[model samples]
Target: MRLLATAAVITLSSIAVAPALAQTMPVAPSVLPDGTLLDVTATGKTTRVPDLATIRAGVVTQAATAAAALSDNANRMSAVLSALKQAGIQPRDIATANVSLQPQYRYEDNKPPVITGYQATNNVSIRFRNIAKSGAILDALVAQGANQIDGPNLSLDQPDAALDEARVDAVKRAQARAQLYAKAAGLSVSRILTIAEGGEIAGPPPPMPVYRMAAAKAADTQVMPGESDVTVTITVRFLLK
Candidate 1:
């Protein structure tokens, strides 16, 4: 119908450049259809600020004996835990990620390896609910013997609701596209033959970029959480009459 065509065009225009994210999905029907099979695919996008951040921080110590290395690491680890608590990191937010003690070896050609010392490493995964204070917390952790800091894996604490919104948008986009193709071919959309959900970014994004300001009034680590993109794509097969 004319109204259907107009609505389809309106929907298409609302999502400018969205066509670049999708194409006609290739599909074959199991049974012969009385009408034509028109396939359409579309993507939906949404932006959200990250609500959770995860960091891996720990200490590394080396000593001539394994016992000595373990003892030193434990003492340093205690200070690190205290610092985390002082930074308002809840006990539930702190988890031991890794703890290991390995022997240091010196290797030479045509000779057996020699034991040099023992290396101890203890790392904890720290989840920060207050992202703004993470920079200051890292500084405090460093002051308390945390030598290795790995992340700030930023993510949405509750992504299910956001993902559902994207799904609705994607379905709307696909439906509009189907109408467009049917109208162009002098046919009417009769029914939806198939609905298939596509891939999505379901996990935390890569670690954020962090920096340490030295020339400023307070030399401390800075954490920046820019906007993250949540996308969903779907393919719909329409029976055109």
Candidate 2:
């Protein structure tokens, strides 16, 4: 489990914060017979290729009236959904992210803004487990009246295991550093007194623009999710004899 609280307290505050279900007590060294205390902070990271992709596909339409704009958006969005299903996307991986209707206005030099037409947008967020086929699916979506394509944000499908591995690496590095310090001080390492961890830092790549079919009709869209780094940092207290 990830350590939410940095200081390990046996008892939590009377008014504990939500989401942090449990508190871990810091270990206290029972014996301190002639020893020096040392604190070591170390960070470890691991790189892995992202296994999942996220894309926002949407239909945008403008008409004279709100009802007409909405109606047109709904019809085109329905076709987009059908195209997604036809491309082997699962129902669970597809979700409606946004639906909005706003008035398009034209601004004049010396007069109040004039309402031109109503613009309707319906967007769906799709998770592609198969990164290889994500590009093709995005192209298909564009062909089916989907004009607004926002992202191809690549990320890991499962990060828990990778994070755990990083934690273990961090602990090992801390131990190694502690040993080095003990040797430098002409003392042997004894035991650990406490261990605290900062928040994990794992971030995906920034969003990339996926071109619509009109501008790039010559070729199929391609997605290249390079790699991401998962890092864990830990501070450990050591006793040296």
Candidate 3:
């Protein structure tokens, strides 16, 4: 009875070990009889109209002390915000993007730099839903003590439809490439193994013709909003049989 119990224990251990060894084996890709490798890539693109404008404007102030510099920046920014609001900008449309106060430094030969004064900055982001009013709003802000301005990044408010269109185009391109490969190999396209898409919208700033604004009768700062383009690219892989 002792011998039979020992034999049964050995058999059970062997059975458990066999399954683990099998599970450790690596999976290999399927191979065709003719040794033909299947690979294909596709690309697609689409364009979209822009519907929104984002502008970055700010007030920069420098004074003998940090408190004085900050106070000056605050007063100038207040005027700028008021101008934007009077121009029909909503509260949500205006946001304080950044506020920074740093000490100014003056370096002398062979001596450590000394803090001369403090420079304070307050930047605001403005979204112009009404594109037509963008130029006037910018002018008003500048007139109200806003010294720094950057961007007016034009873009579409919603880009879902454009992306969908680009996706379909990409898949179609992948299918066409797969079909070409399969035809050459005397086989046929079977299924899509994988599909991936990545793209970004590019919006360069509109050329701002500088204006002296010496008088109200000065020629208005002419702004021409040319067409904006939305670009999309995708990669797709198809299986051939």
Highest-TM-score candidate: 1
Off by over 4 Å in 3: 1-39, 199-219
Predicted structure 2: lDDT: 0.74
State the lDDT at 71 in candidate 2: 98
Cα lDDT listed for each candidate: 0.76, 0.74, 0.65
lDDT of 1 by residue, 1-241 (tens): 1222122211211111122333444556566578777667677667778778889999999999999999999999999999988878999999999999999999999999999999999999999998889988998888889899998877777777766787788888888788777887798889987777655634444555467667755677878877767776677777778
| Candidate 2 segments exceeding 4 Å error | 1-35, 204-217
Q: Give the TM-score of candidate 2.
A: 0.77
Candidate 2 per-residue C-alpha lDDT over 1-241 given as tens digits, one digit per residue, 9 for 90 to 100 = 1111122211111110112223343655475445677777677666778788888889999999999999999999999999999999999999999999999999989999999999999999999999888888888888889999877777677767776777798788888887877786677778977877754653544446443455645667878766666676677877777
Which residue pairs show collisions in model 2?
Answer: none
Alpha-carbon runs more than 4 Å astray in model 1? 1-30, 202-207, 212-218
At residue 124, give the lDDT of candidate 1.
98
Q: Count clashing residue pairs in model 3.
A: 0
| List of clashing residue pairs for candidate 1 | none
Cα misplacement distance, residue 64 of candidate 1 (Å)? 1.3
Candidate 1 displacement at residue 10 in angstroms: 19
Candidate 1 weakest lDDT stretch, 10 residues: 9-18
Could you estimate the TM-score for every candidate? 0.81, 0.77, 0.75
Q: Show pairs that collide, candidate 3.
A: none
